[model samples]
Target: ARRRLYPKPFPGIPYNKVSANRIAGDLPELIPVIKATNEYSTSMFAISTQRLRLPLAQDPREIEDILVRRGREFDRAPMSIKTLKNFFPYSFMGKYNTPEVKEQKRIWADAFGADFLRKVAAPSIYNATLDLADGRPFEVVEDLHNATLDAIWVALVGEEAGITRHEIKKFLQSQRDASDGGRRDPGPPPRGYLLRREVDYVSEMIAKNSSSGIPVLAQKLAAYLPRHRQFRRTVDTEIGLVMRKAVDRFQRLELGRLEAGENDTCMMDLVLRRKVLEAKKLGRPLMDPTKDKVLLDDTFLMMFASYPTAQTELRAALKVAFPHPTTPSVDELLGADIPYLDAACEESLRLAGVAKGNLRQTVVDTHIMGHFVPKGAEIFMNYHVDHAPYPVDEEKRSASSQAAGAKLAAREGISRGDVSRDLGSFEPRRWLVKDEKTGQEVFDAYALPQLAFGGGYRGCSGRKLAVMEFRTVVALLVLNLEFLELPEEMKTLKASETIFRLPDMPFASLRAL
Candidate 1:
């Protein structure tokens, strides 16, 4: 059995090794492992000490076959839930499997329905992109990240949170610290600190205005303050308080709008409606603003989750994918197909696997791929490992070759495989195909790839919104300015494993066309 599983000594090197007693860690670069696992099963691997597991699938079909068809059989693997607990203690309130989580998911999912998504999200994204590209050589990651944050905030909250690069950087630092059990140097001040400060600033403004009997004037003044130092105190305290107040204010505003028959189509408004409708459907009383902090938590959590991931991914994508000197301009990208951009974003996500590894604790003794997985065993699926290369049909190979050729041509004097192999390697076009006879297009023609949002009944509820945001950001970047690689000396940016793969530092430089 050992010989069968360890046949021929796996050739690909492991990405990260920590004393032989632990699970061998794989990095994004180890695509071959993912490819091999997708193609064949090997029981020699043990994800945890007590249970031996099989190789993962690389193609989407196999992923779907397992996740979709037999989803109940497999469960979400355990991951570091500590960070989530610390940051969002109130929502799931640190409980992973709770009624609150289910309720929050249901409310958020309902709020992001199709019509609300297209109208509110799409235009907001377009405008935000244009605003970011208003004649600046801004770092693509920073700019793109801010754009996504602003767009999501506007869509969901009917207001912008005034996101800034420094604030985002600090927020990311806090999340990273939380993930490592608060171990690493406590990098930069906690972002919660900054949010608390902002809340104080707004509250003071509101208080001052209230005394003057002019609430509107105070709001206008607070809105005008710069994002940085807008609040004079810590972010957590200040922002938390303000959000509490805003939730109340928005609820009342929504009521007035409804009374007046106003169709204010924003995320906050949509969620407010859903909450009421759901309350009625379940035969429960309407959400009490004062008691049930669920709505407030849901509103803020959505903003928080949506912002950092989008920012981190956007930055990582630009840092790795853009060619130096003469990258594809943002304007050129905007005109491209939404699906193609979506594919690029998906490819980036697969390569990065932002959430890193997912963990599951066994509920009952079960066998997976001929290996015994004992009850209570902890299992992990390294998403990065599941994204390796596998057998590709003629069409896929051709598309990959074309994308490679295009990169080579763009480099002009550089060696064929230098930049092409290390960074800027993935080609979105590799995922597309055109019919030879009629020249019609085919979407995801390759066998099912391991790129679904996730698996099971718990699959991503906000997939539609996420796709729209990704497509909009990519298109805007492609259209506004070309994505160029920074000079060789400045090209050593690394992905920091925070809540997502954020740049270790601001991406070197992005030149505007």
Candidate 2:
């Protein structure tokens, strides 16, 4: 009767037999794993009776099948949608492949288009990075995070956020105020420095939200906790700031006060301008920015999601690319021929491993890595472990995937196993290939199994924008400054995950080139 009353693992799949007997199933075992890794790292352990689990996919070929080819078999996990919807209701992050999501994507499609990225986003990112070349031994992670915030803010609102600039000004002031003529490295700025209250609040809330796997329950319980209550209040205040910026852009469009060229408008102006055009075409009234929940929600989501990944990956890229601080001009760094820099960035992205994996739900009963997944079962494509040197159980993979894997293995520079031994190290040359037409080596994205930005329709929509921002920041910094070698105590690679994976020790001792 208990077997029927409580959930149990599907028949013929691997599971903890002892967990099946308990009402909590895998909760007892799962907590420890989450505590250690900030993620579910129980590869192939399907002990979660709440849902049939395929913990992590060790094979990249099968990952491609699940994310791309077999879309009918797997899709965005329902639990993921449920959890994220509370925070990002109108954003694509929380939605399935429906008409609404398609429309949302279409409306904002040009935001990341090549022309917009080059003319609008790139300049904004370049301007933001200008404040960082002061040659102080600043906290690399925090400063970069602020720089990203500034860049994204300018892209979204068509004005300077001055976040990084403000921090720099404060840092300079702090140094000047010191009795010893500011010669000492005072380390990263104190918490709540100037406009960082909102940033800290967002981080605190996300960390608290993810700490308990059950976000919805945790959200409800948050109302009673004093710290959480403050976080909610601050987040709400931040939302007001975002909404007001939208309102300002909307009013400017309505009043024909666009100071920049039509093509150079901020992301908010682009959306509002399109909306105005659409309303005029349909003979409807102009939509209010305050009333359009989709507009407000997606803008908020973009601000929160854009920065952390680039900052983390940039740290990894810098560590790999510039060991002795040889500088290049900005033109050389951003030119088409910098294959080494490009390769280093790709390698760092692979090593950063911000997300543990992406979750997918089975649309119908299907096979993954030769195991039977029941309809509605959830599976995690464990890119984090797959990028590592985990042994692939080839016999367990489906025949079609096996054929695909075999075909990839036959090609030189295609198979991941070719460089399996060096997977853990930072080697950029692995991603470089001699271009037959140009007779010059170039970074080949396909050289490695690419899952950093994810794949298919449900993949990260802002990937292009993120990459552009990352490359621009990395190039500017690498060209203009020399990142000095850190002391042993400051070289720790420990990271903490919340909204995104972030380095715990993100300092960069530097000198002006």
Question: Which candidate ranks first by TM-score, i.e. highest?
Answer: 2
Q: What is the lDDT of residue 237 in candidate 1?
A: 45
Q: How many backbone clashes does candidate 1 have?
A: 47
Best by lDDT: 2
User: Please, what are the lDDT tens digits per residue for candidate 1 over residues 1-513?
Assistant: 534432121113231233122332222223344244321112113222222232333333334434444444555543324323323446642345456667777766756777667766666655655566544566556565666666776676555544543444555677888888674443454343344343334334433442332334544554545652333223344334544554454445444454432454566666665555455556787655434555555555565556434333444444444435343443434434433445576666555455443444455665443344556554544444333334545343223334543553564322221211322345554444454555544334232244435555555556678767776655455544556666665554345433344554455344455
Query: Candidate 1, which segments miss by more than 4 Å at Cα?
Result: 1-66, 77-83, 90-100, 164-262, 277-287, 308-339, 385-424, 445-448, 489-493, 504-511
Per-model CA lDDT versus the true structure: 0.47, 0.65
The alpha-carbon lDDT assigned to residue 328 of candidate 2 equals 35
Candidate 1: TM-score? Answer: 0.59
Candidate 2 lDDT, 415-497, residue by residue in tens = 23254445766776777777656666667776767677667777777788887777776676765666777899987656666
